[model samples]
Every structure is written in C-alpha cells, then in structure tokens.
Target chain A: MLRTVLTAAIALAPMAASAAEVVSAVLRIERERPAPISRLELPAGDEGFMGALLATRDNETTGGFLGHTYVLHKAAALPEDATAALDDLIEQGARFIVTLAEADDLLALADHAAGRDVLLLNVSAPDDRLRGVDCRANVLHATPSRRMLADGLAQYLLWKRWDRWALVHGSHPRDREKAEALRAAARRFGARIVSELAFEDTGGARRSDTGHVLVQRQIPGLMQGLREHDVVVVADESQVFGVHMPYRGWTARPVAGDAGLRATAWHPAHEGFGATQLQRRFEALAGRRMTDLDYEAWVALRAVSEAVTRTDTADLATVLAHLLSDDFELAAFKGMPLSFRPWSRQLRQAVILGDGFTVVSISPQEEFLHQRTRLDTLGVDEAESACPL
Target chain B: MRGFLAGAVALLALGPVAAWAQVVFVTNEKGNSVTRIDVATLEVIDTVPVGQRPRGITISNDGRQLFVAASDDDTVQVFDPETMRLIHTLPSGPDPEQFVLHPSGNPLFIANEDDNLVTVVDVVTRRALAEIPVGIEPEGMGISPDGRVLVNTSETTNMAHFIDTETFKIFHNTLVDSRPRVAEFTRDGSLLFVSAEIGGTVSVIDPASGEIVHTIRFAVPGVTPEALQPVGVRVTADGSRVFVALGPANRVAVVDGRTFEVKNYLLVGQRVWQLAFTPDERYLFTTNGNSNDVSVIDVAAERVIKSIPVGDQPWGVVVSPN
Candidate 1:
C-alpha cells in the first residue's frame, strides 16, 4: 500500500502547496535502551509515531474545513543511519520534522539541517543542554527538561512538608545528570538531602522478578541504616533500580523521582481538563495507553496544526512563523494554552506528577510565584535562560 | 386566646416562602452538598446532601423538579425543589458534566464527558430516549428557545454539534475555540454564544448557517492574558446584555448583546465560574469555586452587591422561578 502511494506521488512529480497539501515528518533514531524494571513498562514499536499519526487526523478535522489536508511521513533508523533517514525526509520536501532521539543524535540532525529551511521539534530529549547552553534557534522542544521534571516533583514534596530527602542515584551518565537536576531542585526549593548513596549497576537482569527471594532481600539492606529522611528520591534514568526501590525503602518513607511519584508530560489516568476524551481517542487509534513520548510528539505536531488552521494555508514558512510567535497559543489540554518561549524555543507547559495509575498533582504549586507566568517556575526562567536566541 | 393569635401570626411568617419570587441553589463540588438561599432575605435557607461530586444544578421550567449532575456517581439525580429530596435518577451515560432541558420540558439532553455521547432522557418516563455520539469530551448543552435544535459543545474536539430535536441526530458541526464550556442562545434563538475556557474567547455563531459572526475577547488591566478563561455564559432574556463568567480571572465580563463588544468586567470572588440569574433578571449569582462563595451581581448596575459564603468548592448555581 505504501509503495502504491509513493509511486502515485512520484507520478504527480511537481507537488505544490497549491494542491492544499501540508507535509511533515517524524524522524526517530532508535538507540540501544536499558530495560525498565518491569515487563509492563515495555514500549510499543510505534510509540512516538503513533502519536503523530493521531495528530495528523486531528489536524485534518479542522484543516479539512479550511481546504487543507495534513500528511505525516514516519521514518525510524538506528543511531548510525539517523542522518541518512533525516536526509531522505528532507529530500521528500518535509520542512517540519518532529524528532524522537537522544541529545547527541538530535543535535547532529539539527546541525545537518542547517541553512536548509528546516525546523526540528525535539520530543524526547530531557538533556538540559539542548535547551540551555546548546540551544538552537531552529529547534523547539516539547519534552520537559530534566530540571523541570525534578522541580515538579520537588515542589510537590516540599508542599507536603517533606523537606528531608534520601538521595539515591545510579552510576550512569544520564542518571548522574538526573541526580544533578534533583540536587538543583532540592537547593532551589529549600529542601535538604539528609542522606546520599550511589548504586553501582552490576549488570543483572533488568526486568528482575520481584518475587525472587534473593533480590527482595538485597534491596532492603541498601538503605538500612540511613539518616532519617522524609522521602527517598531516586534518579535512575538508565532504568537500573528506581522502580524496584518504591516499596523497599528502609524507613518506610515514600519514593519519588523516576519511581513512585515521577513527573511527566502526560499520564494515561489523567482525566482532568477533558483529557479523558483525549486518552480515549488515542486508545481508539493506537490500541494502547498514550505514553509520555506519544503525548510530546502529539503536542509538537498539533502546534503545526494550530498554526496551519489559523493561517488557512499549507505554506510551511508561514505556519512555522506562527508556531514560534507570541500570537500563537494552542490549547494543549494542560489546563491552559501553550506557546513556545522566545529565548529558548521550548514549549512552556505544566508538568504532571503521577504514580503510574493516577495523577498526584500538577506543579508550579500555587505558592511558588513568578512575576511572569507560574509555569516559568518549573524550569529555566527567562532571566536565567542561557540560550542566546 | 393569646396562644391561638400567636400561632396564626407564625403562619404569616411562613407564607413569605411561597410569595418569594425565586430562590438560589448552589452545588458544592467538593462538599457534595446543595445550598439553598432565600431570595427575599438573601439568606441561607438550607443545605442538603446530594450525590458525589455534584455539579450542573438546575430547576425545571415550571419549577417542580431540580436536576443535578452527580458527575462522579455517573447519574443525574432529580429532586423535589420544595422538599429537597431525591426523586429518581436518570440514566445519564457517564460523567454528565452539563445538560439542557427542552422547552417542552419532556427530554433533557446531557453532555457525557467520559462516554463521548449525549444521552437524551425523558424527564417524565425517567428513561434514556436516545444516545447520540458526538465529539470527544462533550459538554455545554444548549437548546434553542423554540426547542427545535440542540447544541452540544465538546471541549477536546472543539466543535459545536447541532442536533435536531425530532430526529435526535447530529445534523451539523461548527468548529469553535478550544475547551468550550458553555453554549447559550439568545431569547429569540437567532444567535448562539459559546465560551471557550482555555481559548479565553467567546465565538458568537449564527445557528442558522453555523457561521461564526463575531469573536469576543476579554482583557483586564491586572490579569494576565493566559489567566482570562471564559467559562459560563448567560445572555439576558431581553438580549441586551451578555454576561460571561471568566474562569480564574475572577471577573465577569458584561458584553454588548448586538455588537459583541466587551463592555466591562466586574470583579467577583476567586475563580468565578458558573452563573445564574434571578427570575426577575434583577440579580445574577456567580458560583465562585476557590473562594467557596457566591457573588450576587445587580444586573442593572453591573456591581457585585454581596458575596455569600457557601460550601466548599461551589461549582454551579441556579435559581427557581416563582
């Protein structure tokens, strides 16, 4: 079926926006991933692309009325072949690309697209540098920065008056960065890390059987004699041990960070702000629960949709300009309208703190005030932004 | 003889309840209770417990039955207004957020947020007459004054579905701003006003052609643009003034009915959301969620006359006619 469509497009040769065709793409670079602590956390094959697909349909609902149709090209590649895939999409005349990749590959692609009339949206990278010192004008990010997620969890913990933290981190680079973000949040929120430990990844089965007697016994012994803390904050971005530490804490305190109370962009069980229907619609299309990556990708594409719907044209430059402008605010089902920041080009949105089943709270926790919008309190504020653009 | 004369005088004091032109009922979402206030005295009459997470409260046109959407309970509980007792339950699909009654007073069209369908229930038979599939997260049900058309606005879908009353089928859909919370029609049913909560604008649509005639925007000096979310909308019976409850902005915008211009914004309690007017149209009561109170606005003067404290998280308010 895809071959037939491509051939038909080739036969038509000189495709133009005058045909009411709006073209975009999703370029995903698949890197080797460490498994999560449970089998239930396994990812579907089309995790992020499925979200873009749903968004194309939603865009068409409004775009069809305006005499425009949306088309999304999906491509996935391994780390080594990522740039080739990106080039393939660019050759197909896709100017707007939503990328699902880690920091290194994503930045490489952005650099490769330089001076090519291309704009890339990062939907999965949590590296602060991508939005901070390494920020680019042609790139916009919808994913929450590591500090934003850490601060969202930190605010909820502080609001509960749980000021003392038992900080535990895995011995990986990404995990260390997550740990650093957590430490930054603790200092920013007036909390103290009373105890700290680094758990070395000894290379065992990642999806460990919880009922195994030996693993159960080894877990509780780690935090046995720690100093008294109100909560156990774990930073295990490599999926080493955070999920396993939830119910096995020594002091019977609650766990947060990448475990029990993780901060995210969207949650499946989140029913607030008409999200129940959104959740249902995605389930109908994808036949699965909408993951955080799916939601970020969906938001990125919808930004283009909102721009196209408003401008009533399929012109990529016009739509891209509106997407990055102050006049553009899309109702993103986050209890508010969302827009990109002028300095860093990051999507400003609220973070959802959930426990996998239900939403615990949303952050920027009413008391934390900003002279601007309260959402600025979660991540890098404008005054503190390191981005030159 | 003195005892009998005093008892007769007590009957006169009770007679004021019947002579009252209207009374107020506020639904407290968190408190799970309904508060009734006397219009004559502007005092609390009684507070009665209802179903879980009670919202979208209203009285019948003839003022006999009061309907409340117990959203969490997934049912619409009908009650007797005078006695404050639950009469029966209508088979509301699921999570009935808001609903509108037909002018003939037989069927009520309800917006079921969870099911993505609108359940039409017969008030007299207490049965679901039809379930019409609509856009996702259906809310804001508004019927025409002549009872020919029913409009249901879905928040996530951002479309106003126009359903024919006779066929109980969706005939046309008109796209509006995001997160539309209320759909209101003018008394003559010529124009429809739909308020978008997150979009912070009201799209005035011509129901006949399903075309948007004007889009009204609101701004206050001290409030941020992002904070100005328009929720509940009410147009006066005379169609001269349109009042919109601005969610989180804590102000109600009074608009010119014909020009669709924002005339003024009257400050009220915190998170002022839903609104209801007295039968005489002299007073408008707004349910303030955060402040746990209701702000009574003098319609003619465009001023908040009083703030009466109610239960926790007051969500919806309605007044029974005389």
Candidate 2:
C-alpha cells in the first residue's frame, strides 16, 4: 500500500520514497606507487579508499531521507594482481565501480567490464589518451587530464603577464607526457616557449643525506643557459627535481607547472567557495588532509550518487544513462555545477592554482572564454574530437 | 533662557528613538564579534565581542534581546539589544551553525551541522527541551508563521524535514537540491522557500501538500550559472516579493511573490551569504563573506544604497523588530 502511494507520488514529482532499498558501489583501486623521497609525501594507506569511505557516508546521508542506504566496497589491489581483483569484484556482484588505476590497466579493466552491465568511473589516471584515442564508452573520468592541468596553469601564468616560459622536463615517460601537454597548452593559449630542455633521470638515491645539497647546485646548472623567460615551467610528475627549481632558478622568475605555483584538481589549503567547511568535515572524518586522488575518488562516488538520487533508482544501467545525459550536474563545491564533456566524458572542473599553501587563482582565468563553458577552455573541446565514442 | 534649556533637554531625551529607530546586528564568523549598525545613519555604531565563530543571529519579537549562534563555542549567546550586554546563553548542540526562533517565541531550533539532530531550547527555561533527529548536517531552520510546523534543511541529506511543532516529530521529508542553506516560509504560511547553494535554484513548496509549487532559477547577463548559488531567502510580510541571496554571484534576485517571476537582480558585495530586513521591510541588509562588509538594499527601490564595512567574515544579519 505504501509502495503504491510512493510510486504515484514519485511519478508526480520526486517525492521522498518510503521503500527500503540498498545502493552499492565499489572502488576498484590499484594501490601501488613508487616510494616517496620525502616522508611528507608518503601515502596514508587509505588515500583513495578514504575518499570512498567519506563519500559513502555522505551518500548515505541523502539516501537515509528516502529509505535508501549506500554501501561502498574498496577493492584495492597491486599492479600484478589487477585482473584477479577485477574478477573478485565482479563475482561479488559489483555493478557500479569507481576505478583508480593506471591508464593501461584502466583500459584493460574497462575492456573486461564491457558488456557485463558494469560501468567504471575513472578517478586517478590523468592520461589524455584514456579520454582521447583509447576512449571507452563505458568509462567516465572524474579527474582532469594532464592537458587540462597544463592549460589551467598556462592560462593563469599568461593572465599574470608571464607569457614567456622556460620549460624543463625529466627523462621519465610521465614527465615527457606532461611536458608535451605543457607544449600543447602554450600553443593553445598563445604563450611563447622561449626554451625547452630535458633533465636526465640518472637514477640514484633520491633521499640521500646530501639530496638538497646536490639539487641546489644541479638545478642552478640546468637553469644557467636558459633563454630569457618570464617563468620556468617544470614537468616532473615523478617528483625528482620539481621541488628544487622554485628558489634555485638562475633568474629570479617564478616557477610554475608541476612545481611552485602548480595547477591541481584539489589542494588541502583551498578554503574558498565553502571549501573550508568541506575541508573541516573531511579532516574530522579522516583525521588528515585531503589529496587530489582522494578528491577524485570522492567525486566519482558522488557522481554515481547524484545519478542515483536524481533517478531514484539504484539500477546501474539507469544511473549510467542518467549520468551521460545533459541533465546531469555534480555540485562538488568548486563554485560550479560540474558536468561531463560529451566527447570525452571528462568531468569539467576549476583547476586550483596554489603555492602549496595559498590558492592563488582558479582557472580558466576570466579572459580565456569558451563557446559553451569557460571550463571547456582548459581541456579537450568537443570540436577537436579525437574520441570517436 | 529657562524655557529654552528645558525644551532642549526634552528633545535630547527623545533623540535616540526619533533618529535611530532600529538597530541592525551582524555576526562576524572570523572576527569573533557582532557589529551593530544604526539603521538611520547606515553606519556601524558598535562592535561587541562575542564567542568564537558566531554565525546565525536573530532578535526577539519585542526587540528586547538578540541571539547569536556562537558556532565554534557550542553556545547561543543572547544579549540585550539596547545595552549590547550579554543576557545569557542557551545550550546549543555541537557546532550549531544556524537556528530559527519559534513564532510563539519560546523554543528555538538550532541546527547542529556536526551532529545529525536539531537541538530545541526553551528560552524561558534556558535548557534544551528535546534533541530531534532529522538528517545529516542539518543547517537551515524554518518555522511556520502559525506555529504548527517547523522545517529544517540538512545540507548533506538534501531534504527539508518537516516536524510537528507540538510533538517535535518529523512528519514528512521533502527532497530538495544539494547543499540547501536556508528554508523560509511565506508570511501567510502558504508557501515555503528552500534555497540550495550548489544547485543554484530555490524550490518553493506548498505547506499543506508538502509539494514543490515552483522552482525559481536565477541568471545574470555575464555571470556563469555555476556562480549563482542561492543561500539566504527572505519574503515580505505582505507576500508580494521574495529576495534571495546568491552566494559567490554577489547578487540578490528579486522575485515576484505571486507570479514567481524574477523581477530583477541587485548586485551587492562579494560572496553574499545571508540577508536580513528592517522591521518595516524598507531596507534589506546582506552579509558579504569575502568582502567583509554589509550591503544595504533599499527594498522599495530595489537598489543598494550603501555598502557598510563590517568585521571579518560576516555570516549572518538580523535587525530589531520595532
């Protein structure tokens, strides 16, 4: 009798349903990373999973009003144990999964989960190819691509009248990819790349007692013969020497890109646009600060929750359909109602530019405009679609 | 000479009432003080130190006392409106961010953002009467004009829990947009307005049916849709107009009460968070968080007459009743 009234009332509008139901999702994560050179940068053993934990509680808050309970499972696995983890979750009846894996692994998982009535929400992988040439229809991305971050930083630098850049990239593949993205950003934003140089990895003990002493001399030596530039943009995603280039620049120009005033999806120091309260809530829940990966994982589950709430159903197919529709918007406290780019399925958000402590700016800096959304000015636009899906 | 001296003394005695008819108080969440502004002069007259992180503020119907939610201190500090002296404090639950006074003016419902309950305190008894479980992160509190129903909006729950004033039990839950910051009812008790900050829309519900009657969306010419977040809401006594504070968009949307059509957008200070109106409804004051100032809107003309500088992080505002 109550079900009939609820159905009728739901048909009229989205009245709070009185029927008991459970909505479950899984965070399929690859939890292996290179050892951090600094203790300050070490993982807390609950990086992405903690975000899912907090977001599950948050989802449960809204779900409780309508007789819905949200449960999230964290399926963390190492690199070699990926397929087994994926199979385990599938056997456990996981239909909605927010995956935090590397690009190739993510693609493999997407291929594995395809046609199984399962959808993957990518939370951490920043590879543009995942959203570009290798784009999968079943996978949606919550994290911004590397191009988005580079473009976001470039816009802010140009807005600050620092249009001339001296680029320095590491020897690693990830660093090269980031440097290439920076090149794309420069071309798009009309910034001049005065000089481009690559620093060799020459792998050694990154955390020696003489680490800073060697870095202080080597960084200046690298910056010695650089052309006259307004800022030094470093692409060191591996975090080898990015931290050393800020104060050790040959000229006293400001450092940017992956170091100094860097662009990121989320930062612990951000307090604007009601983010302080959010940070406080996170701190209260996790007993630590939030990171970009945690925030992206949180966004993934939240994206799923938004669809579930709007559709008033936990059916994975309906939720995914609703999410892919134009009516979907995620209010993730970035002073915007973030939506997915139709061509790439990448979640559009403001890139926060900060110096590790203060949020200097959020970009697509007011000058660079897009036809649809200013957020589109940062990443891949629909007209340039390399993504066939 | 003796007649002139006597006449001067009599005029001076009536000076405050004749000139400064009303007092407007604003709570500063960062400055840990409340700034009092003389409504007639549109100037800050005094800043009285209060507890830490004061946010929600209200005044008594008779205009005798003022109440402020000292959120970080976990207490609601009450003060004499005229003297600016501490009257007493009612025990607020942990992290009381916002609260609403009962229309009959006894029980106060304080929404505890940390705890998932609405703490009800009786002003006369100065003790908590009941802790009503509503939803998670409850912040906005609204009571019907006829004093039969109370509405509390949970920020995370994304619903307005309607509770019976007599029994203090949640009778119905009306789903709204994300991060609903304020819930307000029309003076006639016919319509309810719940402002969602992140969703950027105001859902107007019918009190009797508990169904949304209208949804008001705001748009400014150059402003991005994302920046237009609705937080604080105020409806006129005659139910002719509605004023909504658009957070970060820094504008107040004026809507026609009858037609629910947006009439105009009045641009105010930066990051506008809350709103309050003078007793006569002639002037509306808004607390701008980023700018640390208050913008006074002349309601009849629908224009900002003055931007009065206040303390740091001004969050809530309330004007004297009389």
Q: Give the number of the best model, judged by DockQ.
A: 2
**lDDT string, candidate 1, B49-152, tens digits:** 99999988888988989999999898999998866779999887778889898988878988888666788888897778777767657889899999999999
Q: How displaced is residue A235 in candidate 1, in Å?
A: 2.0
Candidate 1 global TM-score: 0.83
Local lDDT at B204 for model 2: 95
TM-score of chain A of each: 0.93, 0.93
Go through the candidates in order and give the clash count of each.
0, 0
Q: Which of the CAPRI classes, incorrect, acceptable, medium or high, describes model 1?
A: incorrect
Listed in order, the DockQ scores are: 0.16, 0.26
lDDT by residue for model 1 (A219-265), tens: 78999977999999999989887888877766689999989999999
Tens-digit lDDT track for model 2 on A30-129? 5545666777888887777777778888877777666666777667777677777877876776666788788888988888778887788888889999
DockQ of 1: 0.16
